[model samples]
Target: MVNELYRKQLYFPFSHESRLEMLVEKERKRLLKQRIIMHIDMDYFYAQVEERDNPKLKDRPVIVGADPKKGMGRGVVSTCNYLARERGVKSGMPISRAYRLCPEPECVYLRPRIDYYTRESEILMQIIVEETKAMVERPKFEQVSIDELYIDVSSLRSYKRAKELAKLIKRKIKEKRKLTCSIGIGPNKLIAKIASDYQKPDGLTVVKPNDVDRFLVPLDVDALYGVGPKTKMRLNALGIKTVGDLRRFSLDFLKQNFGKFGEDLYLMAKGIDLREVVEGFEIKSIGKQHTFEYDTRDLVEIRKVLLAEAKAIDKELNDFGLAYRTVTITVRFEDFETHTKSKTFALPQTGWSTLLEVGWDLFKEFYYASKKRIRLVGLRASRLVELSQLKVLKNETRRF
Candidate 1:
C-alpha cells in the first residue's frame, strides 16, 4: 500500500521531478547571477566607416556597397546607415531595389573599400584588447565576426566595473576611429548577444540574473538563437508562441521532436546558457578579402588579390602555430552574382607557396566557371590543426 501510494504520488501532475526542478532552477538562477558577460557589436559598421572618412556624408543618407546603376544594378547592399534605413533601405536588399525604395536624389551610394575597412578593424581590435589588459587579469575576448565580440569579465565581480570598462572601450573607439558600437551585458553569451541588439546604433543594455526570465518570457520564441524558421513553424504548430509557452513543455517532448536542439530550446526559454568566451587565436579559420574599386573581367587583377590574401592568411596561420588543409575563395561578379569554391589537401599546409598556389588554382577555377566581371574576391584557410598536435600525431604514427 505504501508503494502504491508513492507510485500514485509520482504519477501526479505536480510530482517530485517538478518540485526538484523548481529547486534546481532556483539554484541555477542564483549561480548565473554572479557571471558577467558582454557582447559588443559595431553599428552600421561599413556605412559608418565611410561616414567617418568623409565628414561631409555624415548627415546625409550613406550606403556602402555596389553601384546601384540608377536602379538597374544586380547586386545586394552590404550595409547602410540608419538614415537610409528610415527611408526603407536595408542590408542584403538588391541595389536596384534599394534605389527604387529610397528613390531620392541625395542618397549617396559608394563602393566598399575593403582595404580601408580592414585597417579600421585592426585598429579597433587593438584598442579593445589594450582596454581589456588595463582591467584586472585580462578578460576573455571572443571575436565572433569582423564586427562582433563577446567578453567574459566575471572576474571584475561588479556590474559597475563592467559598465565602466564597456564605456571606456566605447570612448576610446570613438576617440580613435570615430566609430560607435552597441553593447549588451548579461550572465551568458546568449543573453549578452540578444541584449546587444536590443537597442540600436550606439546603445547599451544590461540584463541582471533575476531579470533574465522577465526579459525573455514575453519575447518571441524565435528571439532565442538557433530557433530558425523551420523550427519556429514546428513550435508554433504545437501552440508554443512565446518563450513562456515554450517553458511549459517537458524536455522529453522537445527532444522527441527536435532531437538535441529541443533541449537547447528548453534551457534557453528559461534564460539558461552555458557558454564561455574563448580567448586569442582560438578560431577555426582565418581569412582575408578584397572588394575591387570597379567590376572587371581581368584575371590579372583577381590573381594579384588572391596572392596577397594567401600571403596574409599564411602569416596568420604561422603566428597561431596552426596549419590548414582546406582553402576557399568567394567571388562576387559585376552583376551581383556570387560563387565560392574550395579545395582540401590530404595534409595540412603551412607554406606560403602552397597557400598561394592553392588560392590561385581555386580562383582560376571560379573565374573560368562563368568568366564574370569580378566585384569582390575573398580567400579563407580552414580545417586547422595546431602544429604541436600534428607533430604528436606524426610521432605516434611512426611508432605504429
Candidate 2:
C-alpha cells in the first residue's frame, strides 16, 4: 500500500465525462479572463451646461471662464462649446487670447458656475451608479474627474450589452439633465479613455482587444497619456514618433534611459493597464480658513492662528478616524495675491503637533519669501487615508 502511494500515476483512462468536464473548465477560464471597460466623458461640460439650461445659447458660441472684461481678462478659458472651438477658442487658453481670437458677439464669455456644474455632475453620477447597480452587483465604477468616469461592464459581457448600456446612459443623462455625453468601450481602460476622445460630442466607439493594436499603432505617441511636449520631443529624437514605434523600440535601451517609467510606458504601448475601476473617491484634503477683522502683519499672531487651525484639523481628523500625509499653508494678502505652500511626508501622521510643525515650516517658507502683510492665513491637511480601512487591510494581509 505504501509503495503504491509513493508511485505516481503515469496515465489515466479518458472518458466522455472527463472530456466534457475539461471543456467546461476551459470555457469558464476564458469567460473569467474577459475584460470590458467603458470610459464616458461629458462634452464641454461647463459650456454644455450653459447651453442646456438656456436654449438661447444653443446656436451661439459659448465660452465659459473668467470675465473677459471685453478684451483684457486675467484668467483662462475653462471650456468652450464646439461652436467656439471651431473658431480656435479652447479651454485653458488665456481669456485675453480667447477674446482676441473671437471677440464678443462672436462668442459669449461667461464665468464658470462651479456650483451649478457640481449639482449636475452629482445628478449624473447618482443616476449612473444606481442604473449600473441594477445591471451588475457592485458594478465597477470610477469617477476619473469632474467630467469623466470609467465603468467596468465585463460582468454583463458582449458588445451588444455594452452598446445597450451606453445608449441607456446617454438617454438617461439627456432625460434627467438635458446634457449629452460621449462614451467609448474597450477591453481595458487605456483604450477606452483614448477611444472616448476619438469622436466629437455625443459619439460612441468600441474597440475590442483584437482591434486595440490596429487602433493605437496609427496614432501619434503624443496620444498616449502623460506624454507632454518635452516627452514627445525626446521620443521624436529617438525616432519613436508613433505608438507602434514606441512599442517596437528596444526594451533594454528604454530601460537604460527611462528606468521604471520606461517599463510603464512599454506596458502602456501594449495596451495593458492592470488598474481596476475603484469604487469610492476620497476627499483629498480637509481645510479650515478664517478672515480676520483686520489685516495684521504679525508673524506671532499668524503662527497662533495657524496652530489653532491645525488643532481644529486634529479634532476633525481624529473624529473622522483619518490620518494625513500632507500639510499645506494658505496665505492671501490684502492685495488679493494668494499662494499656498505644502510639504508631503513619506508616511501619514495624525498627531496635532506634527500638523503644527509641518504647517509652521510651510508658512515660514512662504511668509519670508515676500515680506508683504498676510491678510489671511489657513491650514489644510491632505493625502488622507482612513485609519479603519488601513487597519482592516493590515489584518487581512496578515491573515493571508
Candidate 3:
C-alpha cells in the first residue's frame, strides 16, 4: 500500500520545474545519507617515533633527518616536533637553517631509521586492523601513507558509533604503541581529511553532512585539497581568499577562468565530494629531489646530481621488481619558478644509464631556454611495469 501511494505521488501531474526540483532534492538526500568516513593521521610521525624510543627527548625539540654540520649541512629537515616548530624549524627546510633556528644543546637531532619506523608502522597497522574488526563487522580501509589512513564505516550508519570507534582506536594505539594520533570523521573523504588536520596532535574532529559548509566556509582557500601555493596565489589575485569568497563566483565564471579544475573548485566550495574509500595502494611513480646548497648555472654539476638520483631510482625499481617507460626531470630556478619535462620511450627501460641520458636531454631544454640558476633538481621514473609482466629486459646485468 505504501509503494502504491508513493507511485501515485510520483505521477501527481506536478509542473515540470517542480518535478525537477523534487528529483534534485531526492538525489541530494540520497547522496548525503549514511556515509561515515574517518581519517587518521599519526601525529608528527617520524619525530614522534624518535621521541617514543627516548623518553628523555619527550618535551625537548626533536628533529629527525640529516645532521646539521653546525649551520652548514646540505641536507633537508625531514620532520620536527612541535617544540621545534615553535622555534621556527620546519620539515623540508634546509638543515643548516634548522640548526640556526634550534641549535645544539637545546635541540635533540637524530637521523631517520627507516627500518625501525617501518616496524613501528607495521605494529600500528595491525592494531588498526584488529580494532576495526572488533568494532565494525566490515569496514573499507585505505592507507594513504605510512602515517595516514582512511576507514569507511557506513555500515554502522551512526555518527555516535563512529565516534566511539574513533575513541577506541585512539585508545588502543596509545595503549599499545605509546603514541598519539588525530582522527577526523565526516560524510566523505575530502571533509574527513580536512577535519583530521583541523587540530594538532591527539585531536578528534567530526563534520556531519549538514555541517560541512559551516566547517569549510571560514577556512582559507588554500585549505581546500589540491590548492597549492601557485593556485592560491592565482585565487588570491581574483579576491578569492577564502572558501566563502570562492563560493560567490558563478560556475560558468570559474570554468571560464580555470577550465576543468574550476568545476572541482566550485563543488569543493559547496562541500561535495563523491569519492569513496578503496582498499589497497598503488605506486604511481618513484622519484627523488635534491636542493643545492647554492644555486648554480653549471650544467655538468647538475648532470652529476641527475645521475646520482637516477642510480638511487634504479636501485628502487630493481628492489620493487619493476621497469619504467617514462623519465621526468624537475627543475626549480633560483627565482623559485619550477617546471618539469618528461620523455616516454616506446618500451620500458631498466638501469640508470637510460635515466641519465633521457634526463640530461630534457634538462638541456630549460638550460638553453633560460639564464636562471637552478636551485634544485629532481628525477622520476614512471609508467612502471612489473618485471614478471615484461617479456624482455634491457641492461639487467649492469648496476648503477
Best by TM-score: 3
lDDT of 3 by residue, 161-221 (tens): 9999999999999998999999999988888999998998899998888887789999999
TM-score of each: 0.72, 0.71, 0.84
Candidate 1 per-residue C-alpha lDDT over 76-189 given as tens digits, one digit per residue, 9 for 90 to 100: 788999999998998888788899877557899999987888788878889998997799476888888778888999999887888898899999999988899999999999
**Over the stretch 1-400, how does candidate 2's per-residue lDDT look in tens digits?**
1122113222324554344334433433343347889899999999999998889999999999878888866567889999999989988776778999889987898889998788888889998887777776446888967888999898886867888888898999889889899999988788889889888699999887668779999899988878887788988999999999997764456767777667557667767666777866555677887555457788778878888898999898988889888888888876757788888886567878998888888878877788787767889999998977766656676795
TM-score-best of 2 and 3: 3
Give residue 224's lDDT in candidate 3 (0 to 100): 88
Residue pairs with clashing backbones, model 3: none
Residue 332 lDDT (model 1): 81
How high is the CA lDDT of each candidate model?
0.83, 0.79, 0.86
Among residues 3 or more apart in sequence or in different chains, the pairs in candidate 1 whose N, CA or C atoms overlap within 3 Å are none
Which residue pairs does candidate 2 place in steric collision? none
Please give the RMSD to the true structure for each candidate, in Å: 7.0, 10.1, 6.7
